[model samples]
Target: MATRWGLCGAGKISHDFSVAMKTLPPGDHQIVAVAARSLERAREFAKKHSIPKAYGSYEELASDPEIDMVYLGVLHTEHWRLGLLVLQAGKNMLCEKPFAMNSREVGDLIAASKKSNVFLMEAIWSRCFPLHREVRRLLAEDAIGDIKLVKASFGSPQLHIPRSVEKELGGGALLDIGVYTLQFVLMVFNGERPESIHATGVLLNSGVDESMVVVMKFARNRLAFCFFSIAVSLPNDATISGTKGTIRVLGPMHCPTTLEVNGKTTQYPLPEPSLPLNFTNSTGLRYEAEEVRQCLLKGLKESPRMPLSESALLTEVMDECRKQVGVVFNQDSQ
Candidate 1:
């Protein structure tokens, strides 16, 4: 295996992932090609990363026989199609967050991936991070004792901004920031999907949810509550409390701002030139890409961290939460 990575969507996220891949152990990984909407953008991205090939379109990238895997950073609406294309073309794929528009879309991708004898996964980088992984370990070991309640949130003051709240683009706090919160809750619950949910939220003119508060109840009285807002903020982080102790995960908490066990808190010293959870940030993308590479080497089609089933259930949770909150987007009402 050449250990080469092909990138679809030479945008901020693909660029970030490329850079992060470079930081890996020498000879383990390399970005060989990139494809984008415009030829010039692809060329520029290739130049920036020293990639060997640049294509003017996604189909061109998907056509590369030498490419072993493709990382997709396209829009959420297009993930399903692009994923199927790559799978059919005989390449593994790691798509950006919100894996697909809904569970049905995810089912399509999953079936295609299996049919094509390849792999597929969601890039929920936060769940694969060292500390985030540690949190799960502690919970399973009962370091925190039997889990009780979970609280999490992620949002910014961007609800008023048109670009950040576009319904057509699948915008809104719930799908945008809230997905992360929901993923956090799901992880702490030991893979059990929520049995019942109660929610409330703010809707935008585009008919999308701008802010939301959700309470998810699982088996044995364990409850997880999440808050998301384009109107306000709440540490935009997470706290997992159990019988023995509590763990607090800080902002953009996927990669974690700070991870504390019990009363002692030790920050992991920020990466050089702080990386935000944006298309331009490589820190989180790097870990996710590495996980994909590792899983592939191990002959796994779905990652143990953020598998396809979880992505499917997570999508349903987000969709139903919106429904319960009486928030209907253009897509939903259609």
Candidate 2:
């Protein structure tokens, strides 16, 4: 049976998700509907994606009987409200990253998922990548010896992007890209909670972080350092140093397939499906989509790879990071 999907936005992220869905083998998945604020926009998206239904408002999409699940591709600022509405309508959801403005909203969303008994998962995507899975496997095998330090940096000149700098939209390097750095470190440490966190960042005129450096101290005398910036470009590489050797991610640490473990390089290619879409980033989204599909078919409410509790903990870390850097948003009050 095909798992029918209703895309909740007509934005770039939704477009990418639609392309990934299109590449899936028949009967595995189907994109049945799309909803946007503008009916014209939804119609255009449906036409481009070959979707059967289009709705001007989200309510219509949420209430559609045919859609078993929805991919909430809207901005982080709108996730909490729209997510509750979808759950109330008895629809499962795969929400985009930076799940909410703060941990409180994520807690509420988890509560709603429990009350509704519908599957819910955050779309971090990277956690499901083949390369990341391999990284964990190698670490568990003690290939890198005792892990001592992890360092990563991600940056781009994205000031022109409205969402990257807008205060109301949950802009800034940390929430926007720093989350990846933090997640990567946590994954390397097998999701160990840090004993202490300290962060410093430069804030834009809009009161959002433009660049930042974060240091986390963990038990077992381990440490992680992350560098994030939107003002300039960085190498975007990540390194994990251990007592015996080091593992270097040769490409974009967030989504790259190439890894150099103790000077032996290996590349893990994306799964068989080919993407014919504008956003190549969509290429990797398939991994998490498949994870979601398997979970749904098994009647699971949360994914083992990217669990709801981890999402809540990550959001809480971001909230504390924002507090240390003095980045506040209007949505934080809610």
Candidate 3:
């Protein structure tokens, strides 16, 4: 049986997700509907992706009895509200990164999912990539030997985008791109919470972080450093160093396809999509979609690869980071 998906937004990320979904085998996954604030926008997205239904409002989409899962791709600010609606409607959900505005919202969403007894996962697609899985395998085998240091950066000149800088929209480099670097570090340390976190950043007039540097210390004298920015372009690369050797993840760390283990380089090219995408290596999203399908097939309530606990931890860390850097969102006070 196919896992029917109802897209909750028609933005660029959602468009990329739709394109990636097409790359998967049609018999296993299906996008049955798409919803947007505007009916015309939803219709246009549906027409472009050949989805069977278009909804003018999220309520209508969530109410559809045919949708097996709802992919929440709306702005960061809307995640909590829309995610709650989906869970309350007795539907599974795959919410985009920075799952919610803050840790409190994430906790509420998790509680709602548990009460509803439905599958729920944060859409951090990188964790499901082949390269990432290989990295995990090597790490478990101690290929690098006791990870001691981790460094990663993800930055692009995105200040021109309204949603990237607006405070009300939950905009900032930390929540937008920094989460990738932080997640990379957490993956290396096996999801251990840092012993201490320190952050410094430049904020725009809008009170959102424009650029930031974060440093964390973990057990066993492990250290991780991350740099993220919206005003500046960065290498976007990540490196994990250990006592024995080093592992390097090539640029665009969030959706990477290349890796270097002890100076040996390998490239895992992305699947060729029939349509152009809005983000880099977005076709790789098929892996997460497939993971979701398999979990649903097995009657699982959460994905082990990107579990709910990890999502909660990520939000908690980001909350502390924001507090240190003085990046406050409207949702933070609620």
Candidate 4:
């Protein structure tokens, strides 16, 4: 049975997701409709994807009875608002990541999901990757021993993008790319919240964080260090060091297909992609989508691999980090 999708937003991210969907075997998934603020944009996206329906407003998409699930590809700030709308419409959702602007918003969404009796999951697709799953298995087997220090960096020269530095858009290194490093660290620690978070960031003139470095203290003498930026270039690698040895995910580790453990390397090659696009490892998106499909088939509300609780915890950690670093989005005041 194909899981029909109502795609919200017709932006680059949505396009990437649609492209990824094309790589899946037929009958696994179907995008039934697409909605954008502008009718023309919605029609264009629907045409490009060969979807049957186009809606000018999100409300129309919400009311779509044919859609079994919605893929919310809107901006970071809109996740909470649109998430509530989707849940209220009795729709399951796979919302794009940095789930909400803060922990409170994430909590509200969780409540809505529970009340609506609909499944909800954050689209932190990296957690569903084969390499990440393998890493978890190795860690569980004590391959790295007691993890002492985890370090990661994700940075890019993306200042030209308005959303990358605009405060109203929930722009910042923390919510944008820092979430990757944060989740990566949490994955190593088995989703344990840090005991203390200390961070410093370089804010743009627009009052959004352009770059940040965070050091988090954890129990059992464990620590995590993360660096992210929207205005600079970084190696974008990740390392987890422990008493026995170290595991290093190679550059572009955020959506890595390869990682090194104890100086030995392994690669998890993605399926041959049908599309040649360079967006966020769309090749791996199918893994998460399949996860959602399997869970829905089993009547599950959240994925065990990337549970809603972990999503909220990650948001809470980011909230504390932003408070300490002084990266304030407009919604934070609301």
- Residue-wise C-alpha lDDT for candidate 2, range 1-334, written one tens digit per residue: 9888999999988888877776666588889999999999999999987899999999999999999989999988899999988988889999998888888888988899999999999888888888887888889899888989999899888999989999988899998889988888877877678999999999999999999999999999999999999999987879999999999886677777788988999987765435455543566777888888999999899998888878887888889899999998887776
User: All models: lDDT?
Assistant: 0.80, 0.87, 0.93, 0.89
Angstrom error at residue 134, model 3: 0.3
Decreasing lDDT order of the candidates: 3, 4, 2, 1
TM-score of each: 0.93, 0.96, 0.99, 0.97
On TM-score, the candidate that comes out on top is 3
Checking candidate 1 for backbone clashes, the offending pairs are 12-279
Per-residue lDDT value at 157 in model 4? 92
Residue 276 of model 3 has an lDDT of 90
lDDT of 1 by residue, 222-298 (tens): 88999988877567679888899998887767567468899778675434423333442346566787788889899
lDDT of 3 at 179: 91
In model 2, the Cα lDDT at residue 140 comes to 88
- Candidate 2 collision pairs: none
- Tens-place lDDT digits, model 3, residues 129-188: 999999999999999898889999988999999899999989999989999998888888
Off by over 4 Å in 2: 271-280
Worst 10 residues of 3 by lDDT: 184-193
Number of backbone collisions per candidate: 1, 0, 0, 0
- Comparing 3 with 4 on TM-score, the higher-scoring candidate is 3
